[model samples]
Target: MPAEKPSHFGASARRLVGRLAPYRMYIAISVALTIGGVVLSTLGPKILGRATDYVFAGLIGRNLPAGATVEEVVAGLRAQGKDTFADLVAGTPYLVPGQGIDFDALARVIMQVLALYLVAALLMWISVRLVNRISMWTVRDLRSDAEDQVHRLPLSYFDKQPRGEVLSRVTNDLDNVQQVLQQTFGQLLSAAVTVVAILAMMLWISPVLTIIAVLTIPVSVLVTVLIASRSQKLFKAQWAHTGTLNGQVEEAFTGHELVRVFGRREQVTARMREVNEELFDVTWRAQFISGVIMPAMFFIGNLGYVLVAVVGGLRVATGTLSLGSVQAFIQYSRQFTQPVTQVASMANQLQSGVASAERVFELLDEEPQVPDPVDTPPVSASRGRVEFEDVTFSYGPEPLIEDLSLVAEPGQTVAIVGPTGAGKTTLVNLIMRFYELDAGRITLDGRDITSMTRHDLRERIGMVLQDAWTFEGSIRDNIAYGRPGATDAEVHAAAQAAYVDRFVQHLPGGYDTVLDDEGSTVSVGEKQLITIARAFISQPSLLILDEATSSVDTRTELLVQEAMARLRTDRTSFVIAHRLSTIRDADLILVMEQGRIVEQGTHTGLLAAGGAYARLHAAQFRGAAVQVDAEKQAGEVPGAPG
Candidate 1:
């Protein structure tokens, strides 16, 4: 069964954070640097406060006699009918009466503050660099794991999943994760530390002002929580639509010719537009909703800042707090609100990352194909003898291939011929173990196949699917893919055997010619021949060819028939026969319908018996490809796939 979609936030976030564990040393160093930077910067406001004290003290001191005490200056001014000014002088601390600004002290404090800020900036820069390393390593592993998971997944997993969606998860989602980490990780940690440090400093300056400043926190928390909850779902939906949009694009590109041939261009365009519209709407709404967090926090922080300022000014006038203290508190107020707003703003990015994270997690969490065995029995040379003992399997609830038994002796060619949905193509799948059996077992050379490793079992077999697949590489490279590091002589021999050499001789580069992934440079029939060449190079003990020559013309097909005759010598083969000629050459022909073999015999014997095989044989045109639906009606194997 396909895995369920994972929910976003907490669990996914935790899982993503857990990825950082391997680099804990680096993260710890980064965290230490961030805290050091914030702590150092926090002291700047307080240090500048001392300079404010000096400047204010000198201004008050200059108004009195040069050596007079603050009390004497206040009394003398009181006696001179200047009571209000006297009280101001009395209330201000560190007042050296009748003295001017302390130039030396001011310079010292200013330089100290400058030095602290410079160091803080340097630390922050280092912290950001460290964060980049952590994120790079983490995202690298994530991509590698996703790729490995894709390889290990069963074909059934892909049958239920769109290739485009899987591609989006591995590409787009992981990229988003990287961005989020780079943008937010260090900053979030720094902002949190700043908030805490500022609160402490504000309390030290005035407990009353600290109380007023913190009163806004509950409101900020409320706004963040409310907006985060709403926008999280929007972000999740946004990525979901992104995957859907990608799937549509992949499908359109994959079937570009088919769409034009069928005149469904407008239909595909309309579907894409619909998904695009949904993606746009959700992304806009998500950004809008999360955008509210920063503004709301700013508003609340401003109210708190204003209140603290008003209260601190009164306290300074009343002599309960120094003017420098009030100034420092004001600086703290600005610093505090900025970090809070930043934290709130980062909430949106965090939500998007979490959404992407869970999408990645869901892929990782999917049950992989049954794990490979810890140990597989070793085998001598395989002679291509295969047996199916009461094998039962199905795609869904209903059983298919139930209690089925069959055997192919060494060096025999078995041809499977049946109508559409008669399980003709399944013979190859069973032999290859693409789909596991539900009951009984299959064996290669009398060793239970499951006991042998999948690699060991598959290594002895060669296959050519109905669809011809090619990669972007030279013709020689494509053929060599079947057997890595094949000698030039070996490659030439295989290509000649598959009739690929004849076509290659005329091309501009011959065997050295490079083809695109789609192999658009060559004709479709030529592409099939290359694939046939690839299979031949594998040199497997057993061969499974599913309409391997279906795309070629009569001339090429006949040439391939001769090549196949030579290739089939002294080897077991399974041919999903689409033409009468292929069936006639088989040592045995299987007539299956609904996953059960209806008849089994040689061509002459089956024709003489006049059973299901005869009907299918009668349906196929002599020495030509069978008509699709007509073959099905006459039970002559209709489609390429099971």
Candidate 2:
């Protein structure tokens, strides 16, 4: 299947952020702490420069030659009537003029710098903690919402898309969203805050140097935008190919036996290789294009750094800027460019995350199945009287069933026999309300089925399909699935009635034997019997058996037929069978052709009329007809009680 188009990036981003509304307090705190950390970090270079300035001033004020003593410098300052300045210098420990430094004063400045760094580190830790909490909480809610959405969607939706494609959205796409939130979101926020703080400090130091550094912004942005524009589409393609690849692997592995039986292993492998090659092609292009962003931004940043150094040095040499200020400006220029580069890299990651979010939101936004009416009544006392009047339905543009009508009264078995695509299963689906009719209505127990809640209506009916399904649990659990609260004795009795106990008793654990997924641990016939036992435990007022005994052996089929006779004794039943012998005694036989009932009567009545049903019967039981003829010639009757 082709990939679905992604949703608008702006809309997906807004919806993703809106998911953080519940944790807005944490988000606010994280923002504040990030600002505080960036501010403190930005002040470090200037404070260190101030300390350097103090040492410079001490040397110049003393007028010290290379090896002059602190006493001589003090004497010189006192002679100039600078007593306060002289005393302030004398108070410094280890204040030898040119031979030694002011160790005491320098230690105090170092301690202040260390204090700022410590506080900044603490703030960063707290901010990251908060962001992580918020991101994890939001992703958890997204996973839960996606899973619940799957259940609410109509069956038709699953019929249209591969199961693995939906699974990829729920698991793989959500994982991408989580990775971006945890890593990229925090980095992006810190980068933005750092950029603003660094630029402000740079301007304060020297507007000339600030302009030199600011010139790089537009160039870097243009490069990043150009590269990202091309990369975004590749990123979208990468994820789409990923979904397709996952679907291929799932399909191949699930049907491995079929592939081997049909000698199509080479074909399956070739198909998988084709999908894998497509995935590799898109993945490398996305990586290569987005990969250009970092290096391009770095080149622009280096250009700005060289310009700042040259301009600031000239101003310092001309006596317009102090050495300490020049030093601080250099540090600020580097800080300013670092965030720009970080932001550029983060932009690529953010685009990929947005692509994943688009897939997830597509599923979340699918229209759910139409709900029952608000004032719908509860199902009345059900006597299993089902009526379909002038019903019509279609799975596509062309209608499959038109003006179809049927009635199954209480305690009657309606056997539906037809060729393939005769709308037999479609009719059952309409009766159970699995698919809504295009027009007309179906009634159960004299009440319009549409007027009653679907849950209430389906609860009173039990279905056993041709392909039986069992979950990964003990055999006992599979049998008791329809009624979870069924007693162990009830489970055993139902199993015995369906003849499942015949094989189950021979297993090592008896009823407690575990079945793997798909119930492949047991034979197909055994699986069908287990489903029959499940329906028996439900004790439904209405029953549907669609080729329920087709997989069983002759002896087992006879046992199941006896059980069916007892099961339909006092309840309404709809039986769809290809074999004409199974439903010979049905109270009403419906022969369908091209989605319409061409004949309706007892089996003998239909055969005597020689209509569609009679032709089907002859086609299926040609040998039986010849045997009846031979028995009649031998003076023996066929179909007589032994």
Candidate 3:
């Protein structure tokens, strides 16, 4: 069984950061841009405040006369050590005693404000772009790694988990992480920088006012911390519920027919509804708490701002604080509170991303089963001979095969036949090393099968199973799947031998006809033929046919059997057949029952002995002509052979 995922959200965050290690340049650029934007925004407010102070000092403190010329106003401020025209207006009074200040300097202030916005906008854009690009690249790598892991993982790993849940980890979890990357990273960085710069500027202008504004900091941090701590666990629960819900949906879709046949749709639906409701509840509570962070911070922020203004106003009226400094303090207060609010808003997104990252990393941390041996030598040459010596096997607690001994010499056809519950299929699985043997060893030619690299062992084997799987592709594509570099002529020939060429020729696009998912557009028999064509195209040194022709109609089965015969000529073969007649001409027939070889002999020998093989043969054919006759009879019927 696979390992369980960790519940900690911080683990996911650390994992996400690790993935970003490859893109240091992008991350650094993004941080730089974010800080630049925050700095510019913080400076804008201070510049406006300074300009207000200059205007007040020039008009009211200096008492400029009515209709004072711009030169006179500047001269008065210059005598007071505010020499620049820009500075004179910045400290001018709003209400002049005799004359109003000129609109020219106000226009300059507006231009400066406009310049600040333009620069800040560019910085914000760069920051957003960098964050988005970095995140997308990270997501791409993560998704690719997940997909590669799926292929490299042992097939047995899939047996214990639902397909939907596995998909949810890659799809839904990754998507959530991507959202976090794109949104939260930028916002959090910018907010932190903005808050720091604004607070510094506020304190620089007036430490007393800065302290007053910061009174809400502890309260806001306490609320955010509490909300964030609870939100992380809820977010983890949300992700888990999502996986469970997806699992249920997947199970329903895959077993639609079964549910209908068994009249259990209501049972399945009720169960799924329960899971779905739980998912909704989990997400709702999590989002609700996370959602409160922003508004709660905003409220505290407004309250803090009001307090700062009330206290600063009294100090200004008492002639202890300058109006310009008080005005600057208000802007700084907004800056400090705004980022804390932003941080609160971003907390859930970051936590959720961390949760997903943890899950993805856990999958990456899984150790692959059947690890390649260190310094293992490659096989010089692979002979088709295969042997099972005192082989014993079990899946979990039940023994599927025990004390099994068998061998197929090079260029020999060994048929395995038995009842439905017999271990014939398990024997083939043992040979393939899909499951390790609990006792004894299996050898290929002179080498233990286990000693050979799985890649090397599998490369020499061709398989055609009872249910042949095909991806959505053209007829030619399916045939060439096993041998990716095979030529068109080789593919056509393999298709012709498997009888798939006959069907392909009738399609509108011939060999180029596109297939639907699971190749459902094709007949079951035709799909089986395609699988055979794929196996034939590979030209493997050894072949295993597990009820290979069981799905094909009589005529197609004959063509397939003929193809199998030709393919088996120079290769060792293991034929696991449900129908006894199919293996009568095999060089050796081993009858398996309850994980043991009950009988072994020629067709006549088994028939004469009236052993397990004879009984199985009787059950399948009732002593009728064994080979093609049963197949011929099956064609006249509508369903698969018993």
Candidate 4:
């Protein structure tokens, strides 16, 4: 049974963050630099306050007692405004216009400001470097793990879902997580620490003023919290719709031939337009709602600043504060808002990041239907004997192959001929352990294939699938795919056996010619030959050919058939075909329909039996190549070159 899927994303996140704990030293360094950067920033305002106090002292030519308060200065000025204290403020002489300025004190303040700026810049540089390194490394680890999971997943998982949809999760969805890890995660960490530090500093400076300044904190925080919670769902929906849009585009492009043949181009385009519109609406709403965070923080923050100014100014007028202290308090008021706004904005980004993280985690959480067992025994080669005993299989809810039993001896060719959807391919999949049988045993050399590791079992079998894919590489490389370390001589020998050597020798680059995507530059028949050559190079104990000659010309088919004869001399072979003519010479033929074998015998025996095999053979191969040619000329099916 598969493991239960996780319901709470928070647990998954904590798990992911735990993986980062190994980088504690780097994280500490980054945090220290950020704190230094913030502290240096605070110094700028402190220096400005000192400069203000000095300028006032120089104008009056009176030295203030150490630790004097701005409120006392304000009270003295007010007293002078009233009576006996009037001459106190008036007696202070002002500096002559254009006279020498207080260069020494001004220079010291400027130098201190520059020093703070320099320290802030240096700390920021170090912090960014450490943070970015951690982020990039985390992304790399995540993507690699996701890709490994995809390769290990059961084939049935792919059968039930579109290729494009699965691909979008790895590509686009992971990219979203990468953006969060690389760009947003570090900022969130720094913002959080800075906000805490500022709030602590505000409370320390003056609890009364701090309380007044933070009057809007709860309201501002509540609003951002509400918005973030709502945007989480919206962002998740936006990502899902984006994936749907991408899947539609991929499907339309891959199946353009069908779309054009059926004249449904406009219909597909209209559907795509609708999908795009849905995605646009979802994205717009998510982003617009998220956008309100910063501005709301700013509104509350500015209101706090105004409140501080009013209260502090009155305290100074009442002789309770010093000019320098008022300046420092005002500066602190501005400083307090910055980290608050920073954290509020980060809440929005964090919501989006969490949404993407949930999607990525979903893929990680999927349980492969048939996981490779820890105690799986390794398999070695033997006389190629395969047996299926009462095997029953299904994609999921619908059973595709049921109560099937068959055997293939060493050095024999067994052909599976069936109507479409009659479980021919599924049989091969069962032998390869691509899908687990619902009920029954498939064995190789008297050992159950399920008891052996997938890698160990598959290593002994060679397959040339109906839809063979040729990766972008040189012709020689494609042929050598069956055995990675195969020499040039081995590659050439396989190519010669498959008759692909004839085409290779004629090309300008001979064996080095490049095969483009899906081998589109080569003819379909030639690509089939190359695929056969790749299988031949593997030299496995058993060979499975799934419609290997279906797309080739008559001359090409004969050549491949001759090669097939040599390749099958010591190995067991299972051939699947639809055209009937290709498998007439098999040692055994099984006619399958509706997931059951309706008839089984040799060509002459089945012909004498006059069963399902005879009926299909008579109708399909009455005139052999001539009937096929007629169908091709009439455009009923695609034709291969002679």
Task: Indicate the worst ten consecutive residues by lDDT in candidate 1.
Answer: 619-628
Q: What would the per-residue lDDT of candidate 4 be over residues 61-148, giving only the tens digit for each residue?
A: 3344334443465466566565323233333223222233476877798899998999898997889889888876776777887898
lDDT of 2: 0.85
RMSD of each: 2.9, 6.3, 6.1, 5.3
| TM-score (C-alpha) between model 2 and the true structure | 0.88
Question: Which consecutive 10 residues in model 4 have the weakest lDDT in total?
Answer: 91-100
- lDDT per model, in order? 0.87, 0.85, 0.80, 0.77
Candidates ranked by TM-score, best first? 1, 4, 3, 2
Predicted candidate 2 versus true structure: per-residue lDDT over 1-642, tens digit per residue: 334665466788898989989998888899999999989988999888767656765565455555767788778878999876666555443345654346677788889999999999999999998888888999999999999999888777888888888888999999999999998777878999998898889888888788889999999999988998888888888887888888888999989999999999999999999999999999898998999899998899999989988997767655466656778888888888888888788776888898898889888988887787787655666899999899989887888899988899999999998878888888888888888788989989888888877788888999999989999999999999989899999999999989999999899999999999789889999999999999999999999999899889988898999999998888999999888899998999998876888889999999999767766776567648676577558643322210
Q: For this target, which candidate reaches the highest lDDT against the unseen true structure?
A: 1
Candidate 4 segments whose C-alpha is farther than 4 A from its true place: 1-16, 60-102, 375-378, 623-642
Worst 10 residues of 3 by lDDT: 633-642
Clash number by candidate, in order: 3, 0, 15, 10
TM-score of each: 0.94, 0.88, 0.89, 0.89
lDDT of 1 at 133: 90
lDDT-better candidate, 1 vs 3: 1
Model 2 misplaced stretches (Cα beyond 4 Å): 1-7, 51-100, 319-324, 623-642
Indicate whether candidate 1 or candidate 4 has the larger TM-score.
1
Superposed by TM-score, candidate 4 places the C-alpha of residue 193 at a distance from the truth, in angstroms, of 2.7
